[model samples]
Target: MLNLSRLSTSLTKHGAHKIALLIRDHDPDKVLSLLWGKVPGINIEEVQARKNLSAGTTGLTVPSVWKEAKARGSETINALVLIAIIFSHHTLIAAMRQGAKSDFTGRITRDVELDGKAYTNFAHTLEELGYSTKHTQQYVDFDLQRLFKIPDLNSLALTLLALKMKTAGWDGTGDLKQLLIDNGFHEVFATDEDQFEAWLSSGKLTAPSFEDADYFLDAAKDSAPAGKYKFKAGHKTKQTGSVSVKSPLTKKTAQLLHNYIQNKFDEQLVAIHGRDCVGCEVATGLGTSIDVVVETAKLRWFYEIKVGKTLKACIRQAIPQLLEYAYWSAEPVKVDRLVIVAVHKLDKQSETYLQKLRDDFKLPLYYEQFVDA
Candidate 1:
């Protein structure tokens, strides 16, 4: 393995600002091209000579560079995408050497399909053909760190926005778009409307990339109220089979719930050696609007917060809603705990129904009244 610490340190010391600039200006592929081209800005001659010496064994390892790129934050991913805009084989090699994981790298390999037969080892082929990975062993251990957790872009976006707003103090609220732009979204997305529409259309917009970040969007919608970011309540209507109405909990509610869970249970759970879980899919299917899934205690927790006079109807339908969430969690999360946390204005009958669930099914069910305090 190359001396990763030395390489990383050298790259950071001499090339960090340049790499940051590359990310800011060009796509990731372009940045990779600069590296592969041994462009004038960063010293690649030494790196090139090293590759020339080791033509086999551990062909140029690029995963390590991407690990560094991601460490540099969203700016780098943007830079990588920019590189892809004007892609070439050299740039592709640069990207593979820098960001492409083995699996994704294979899909982009052009010459590997020998008469419609794909080659198994593209990275190795690239190495044999005068290409080398700049950062290698450093990233080999990355997969291990991700073994016990789920990744949530919603939480990340909120956290990033919160960090950006801290300078404003509690009184100073900031526009989420501006904050996202300041952080890096502007580079990834050329325009606000385009980005926002992309987000709405794909629902793939995350925090970093702003894809699927229901929590952040809800907060923005609430804070501005007039801005386009406000969280819109999902459609609701009366339904049969144990009365139901659509959940009014917007993305804002999701954020609040995330914080509530983290503040209340994160430390305690971690203390008890919980796996540090994230948003679970307790919904009925991938696209269906069922409910949020929270995994804990080796069981799936179904969560819905209900407000207004519709509490009774929501409570009646809660069982079926939870059952839907339970089925979804089975495959990806594999949770066994069944729980429902409902925040609603309760009636005597609704309170009784809540208890009946806890007592009869031996399930972990809870109810809380809507409180302004």
Candidate 2:
């Protein structure tokens, strides 16, 4: 027996009044009637969505909230705001199960009651307003996790959104950071601009596991910054050897080989694509950085620069690291190629293994050997 009045009051308390008014103004009377039916004793209408632009031949201008969201380059924020307003309940399982049709609907139905008809109507209105089912689900999931006191959802959502924007050629870091702070994710995401960009690029922020969710809650309860909170870092490779002293000549040779190969690759990229190619040291989800990454109009190349005495040694280290980088990316396309840039060519055995991986696993992997003049 949920009190609809208390839920409505909670919505108003959480700065959802403007969005609520927007729904009342634009949506039909039947929709309003359905919403009011939930509360059982409220009868008032004639609220309007806020208008932003000057009136034109196109009709009344879009609302400022949506306009601002569009200006920021993500209409998803607009949809999420509306969702936060209309389905302003403490938990979303009920609303989503009854009102939404998404990948989660089946799962939600099995776990929660199917009585939130009002939410279904609201979800339909959101679709009419041009939000996709996936985006709608993301918003619902975000707010639901927030209500459940999960602290990591904010970072996870922003990170994924940033990735989507970046793949579309938009830098959404600034807008997303501000949004996170505004939505009470300041503690976990109060990182400086550079660090925030690194986090998004690395794809370290992901959907939280049960343990991760609980850890975030603990951090929030303790009022500790996310930086100070330590969770178990993933992708730790098994160490094969101990740190041993190396001769000065050996170390120098390795450094020179690495530098030479990297320079040659850069020159080759510039020659092939000129200004269209961009290269950088991209951070990885494993708390490490890729040696080099080159992006062109058609392909993204991930390089592992290594200079060991034998090709086997270089390939052994590069394979695992490159694989981690490829799978950890949040981009729509996986890494186009996994390349081992080494000082010497692969031997028979190394080449045989590489061929097997390509033929059997369909891994787009190769080795590029460089020679210094």
Candidate 3:
């Protein structure tokens, strides 16, 4: 995703190392060494060794769109153009937004066709963010490294390409002959000649779907985040006094964290309760939905998710929403407890504020913090 403000600082401070972290889950250092140590010209051993644990991986899932692309590729396209487009999308966006150079969409305007079309501001912020891992290294052997068993970057790229085309107004079934021109690298999308023509006319070729493409999956670990959770606060039984320090919030960074937190909370609830009883994003009768709702024979819980820099900010936003969701309608949804799920726990002062809400008004509201596991 194009969180350009923080991304600029991240790249300048850490080089490709931080971005590489988001692009891999299992021993990213191993991939770094392979790409850098093995090739001295582009070697980045020093970059690989710098340990900045704060540069965490993006928690995302593999969108189903890539599955269809992979399946259709056996006939029409090979891996090269597919891979080229990945780096292309990342670089092209960078070129347009961050003033970085790109091979496909040259320095602002070497190609007139894209010159009028490729301005950064014209693209919606969400469109710019889709399928991006915040950054991509424009290496020639991008496909080789992607095929080396990592799914984070590739999944993001194809989905990104689709967004770019949608912005450019290219049709899925449109003639791709103009796209088949030689940019000096073995003829673009020329992996299968006979099948390319067949696919061109057959209209079976598909682009990566935008749905769920925002997730950056950690394919190495079944989409689980690295490191054990530092602290957790949900109910008084599992609560802890300690809280996480404030972290930065970019538009893309916040969304990635929010989705990851929601999914993790879903898993935790299922483990504590049971799948049949736990419902996520359940729509209430009021036409609004709760992030995570749990129902047992005896009681029910309404959960609201809020990700913010401070516990106070999260609580302020979550409390009102939970209240309205629980009591807004005449036939209000049954709720024994109203819980708030957030990124950090309360500080002493903030904890006192929440306690007063409980003691004075006797609100059945509770607090919970999300941590990596």
Cα RMSD for candidates in order = 20.8, 21.0, 20.9
Which prediction has more favorable TM-score, 1 or 3?
Answer: 3
Q: Considering TM-score, which of the candidate structures 2 and 3 is the better prediction for this target?
A: 3
**Could you give candidate 3's per-residue lDDT for residues 104-173 as a string of tens digits?**
1212322321232232311211123222223212211111222212223334333434433433444655
Q: Write the per-residue lDDT of candidate 2 for residues 1-373, one digit (tens) a residue.
A: 1232322212112222234333333432222333333444433321212111111123333334333333333234444344433333423323443443322122222124222543343444444444423333323221222211223333434443343234334445456554433433222222323233323334332222222233334433323222211112112222223222231113344454455556666666556656345353555544445666767557777777776545776687678767756763444236778899876666888889999999999888899876443
Q: In model 3, which regions exceed 4 Å deviation?
A: 1-248
- Model 2: pairs clashing at backbone N, Cα or C within 3 Å: 99-120
lDDT of 1 by residue, 1-373 (tens): 1112221111111222234344445543344455444555554333432221111123343323434445556543333322221121223223334433331121223332211111122233223222223313222111111111113333333333333234223234655544444433333222233333224233333222111234224324222122111112122211222212233233444344433432333233334434444332222443333233444446544454332224554454455445443443335334344444434556788678767877897655566443322
TM-score of 1: 0.23
Q: After superposition, how far is residue 11 of candidate 3 from its true place, in Å?
A: 43
- Quote each prediction's TM-score: 0.23, 0.32, 0.35
Model 3 error, position 128 (Å): 38
Pick out the ten consecutive residues of candidate 2 with the lowest summed lDDT: 48-57
Tell how far residue 233 is off in model 2, in angstroms: 28
Worst 10 residues of 1 by lDDT: 140-149
Off by over 4 Å in 1: 1-275, 280-286, 289-291, 296-299, 328-342, 345-348, 361-364, 369-373
Model 1 C-alpha lDDT versus the unseen true structure: 0.35
